[model samples]
Target: MTVGVEEEFVLVDPRSGVTAAEAPRVLELLKDERGVVAEFLRYQVESVTGICRSLSEVRADLTRLRGRVAEAAQDAGCVALATGVAPFARVSPVTDDPRYRRLADRFPRLIGEAGTCGCHVHVGVPSRAVGVRVLARLRPWLATVLAISANSPYVDGLDSGWASARYPLWSRWPTVRPPSAWHGTAGYDAAVDGAIRGGKAIDARSVHFHARLSPLHPTVEVRIADVCLDVDDAVLLAGLVRGLVGTALAEERRGVPLPHVPDVLVERSLRAAARHGLGGPGVDVLTGVPVAHERLAEDLLVHVRPALRATGDLEDVRSGLWALTARGGGSERQRALRAGAGTPADFVARLAATTRGGDLERKAAQ
Candidate 1:
């Protein structure tokens, strides 16, 4: 199975380090590029990797698209912040799309604080049946993945008291909750139909469960991670989700059962991960007990080790993991940076440099 990634970033001014309404310009430059696309907010842009077969392909695609967008945004006096959310931009201009207009009219609070970007991994499945099975088994580990990718710690120019502030903010969407286990493909379709029929979801696509059988693709889409900062971290997130899906599929073929974890316990774990991230303990997957994030990571690695080995991802997983922990994820890094003399402007500035492929050409002009 192949894995792909979709990431969103906030576009900002190259000089002032503030959200810039330069989506139009960036879109114009990327008109012929299918990989770079506009997002809901004018200050937001998205990069979708082509169906990638390995971590290297994922990294190459992300770097290519991110680098292109950064260059174009810089030429237009703007940059892209690869963090989960903009630190200071409280409000933003919505993209000129009817879908966004209807969303704004109906869910004002939802889109009011828009531009909470995410790192979504889409793992190809043999069919919807297999994808649904993978989704059913993926619920318990969702929080673990979130902790691994918790990038948003600041909002409105201050620490938001959550490792991934974007997680809480984005979860406000009505259908964003993790769904209960399904019996099979029929049950999965019923859940999707129920959400749309009950008005909890706008459409099949809006069945925004953290992980779901993609509405339009032959893939299980994992939408729990906050947009990662480093390209390698992005690959790590992608590989982790893919490994989970692969493990689940293998177990399914072996007639393994999805663990019967309570929904309340799963929700608690998610809250714990959002509150503490990897800096603190994470709730156990099967038992709902609290454990150190390091231990939780070890447990996760054990679960996916077979898949990693089979796919030649064991080394990347090991090394990428070390890098993630060594740097302490984006939330930790952001807090540390804020503790220093650096401000929100500086935070966005550093992220812009990362998005621009490490050549931060445009600084705050004197």
Candidate 2:
């Protein structure tokens, strides 16, 4: 199976690290560029990678795409953060476009409150039937995916006391949550059609679940991750998402039934992930049993091992896991920075450097 990645970055001033509503300037420079687009908020920009057959290709695409974005930001007197949220982005101006204007007009409060960057991985599936089955089986494992991708611990200049504040901050929206198992393609389509009748969702793109059958592509979209810091972390997430999809497709092929996990328990597990990430306690999705994050992560990797091996990504995934564990996931590192730095500037400056090209330049700057 091939994988594609979409990363959303927040634009910030290079000096003070405040959100900069300068996407117009950046987008203008990238007017002829492929794989780059403006997001809902002007302070946000998204970059996409083409369908790739290997982790090497994903890494190459990310490197090239991020380099271009960093150059554009530099030219525009801004810096692009691969991080999930910034202290000042929630109040940043909405993009000046018909769709964004319509949304702001319709959901005034939400428009004012909403703004977060995320990483989405799309893995190919054979058909809608396969995709639906995959989605059904994918729900239980979704929270752990989010926990591994937890990078949003700060917002409005405060540590939100959660490993992933993005979880709760995003819950304010009416439609966002982990998906429920559906009977089949028809059931999934019917639920989506029913949702749009109320006008909360104006189009197919509004089918916002933690994981969903992509309306515009032949892939299952995993939308549970914060934009990762280390490029390897991003690649690791893409690999895991593909593994999850591939594993589910295998289960569908075997005619194994999706497990019947209770909705309340699923929600509880999700909250646990948001609270502890891989640093403390986590609730098991299928069993509703409490366990350490390490155990949960182990179970996750074990569950998807076959798919990883099938794709020849087992080594890359394993190495990435080791690196993330050793260096710390973004949430843990961000918290440590705040704890140690005498000022946010020191952290933001280093964060800006890391977003450009990871540790080499960041360390050189220091």
Candidate 3:
């Protein structure tokens, strides 16, 4: 299966670490660059990779896009931050677009505070029916993925006590929730239409289930993860997502009935992941018992091992998980950096360094 990634980054003033509404300028600088585009908020930008058949392709494309955005942000007198939320910034004004303006008017408070960023992975499926089934199969494991990618720890200059504080904050949108085990494409379409008809979702675009069949492509889009701090981490996620989709597709072909994990359990598991990140305890999707996140990760790997091996990603995903756990995930790394920082500026400095893989230092040394 082919995959792609979409990462959202916030532009921050270099000195103060405040989110800067300079996306227009940064985007202007990136006019020659492909895959980089403005987001709903003027302080944010998004990078979309073309469909990739291998992890290396995803890495190369993501690295290039991140580097371009980082350089563009520097030219605009800001830094492109990969964290899920601005650590210390007030709500940014919405971008000047008719659709965004309509959203702003319809959900003023929600739109005002909805600057959360995320990393979305799309893995191609055979059809919308297959994609919907993949989404249903993916629900039990999405929380673990969220825990693995928890990058946002600080919110509004204070510790939010949630690893991916962006998760709950983003959940303020009416349609943002776990995907349901729909019958097939018709069921999924009906659910989306119902949300729109009931005024919960603005349109098909607003059907923000954590995992959903992509409206624009023949893929299942997984939006459960926060924007990772490193390109390698992002690629790791893409590999795992592809593995999951591949496993689900195989099961579907073998006549596997849709799994029946309870919604309440799924929500609880998600909440735990958001609250504690990877180092904390997680609920087992099957048993509803508290398990360490490491154990959860191990179980997930086991479940997808066949697919991983088939895709030649078994060792890479294994090593990546080990590295992530050893260094602590992005949330823990941010906390550690914040602990050593004498000021918010210093924290942002350290974060900005890792966000772009020390590219700035390399450029400066040159």
Name the best candidate (by TM-score). 3
Model 3 TM-score is: 0.97
lDDT winner, 1 or 2: 2
Error of 1 at 344 (Å): 3.9
Q: What C-alpha lDDT values do all the predictions have? A: 0.82, 0.83, 0.89
Task: Report the CA-based lDDT of candidate 2 relative to the real structure.
Answer: 0.83
Segments of candidate 1 deviating more than 4 angstroms? 341-343, 357-366
- Top-lDDT candidate index: 3
Model 1 is weakest, by summed lDDT over 10 consecutive residues, at: 357-366
2 or 3, greater by TM-score: 3
Local accuracy of candidate 3 as per-residue lDDT tens digits, 295-321: 898888899999999999999899898
- Which residue runs of candidate 2 sit more than 4 Å off their true CA positions? 359-361
Model 3 scores worst on lDDT over the 10 consecutive residues at: 357-366
TM-score of every candidate:
0.94, 0.96, 0.97
TM-score of 2: 0.96
Clashes of 2: 0
Spell out the clash pairs found in candidate 2: none
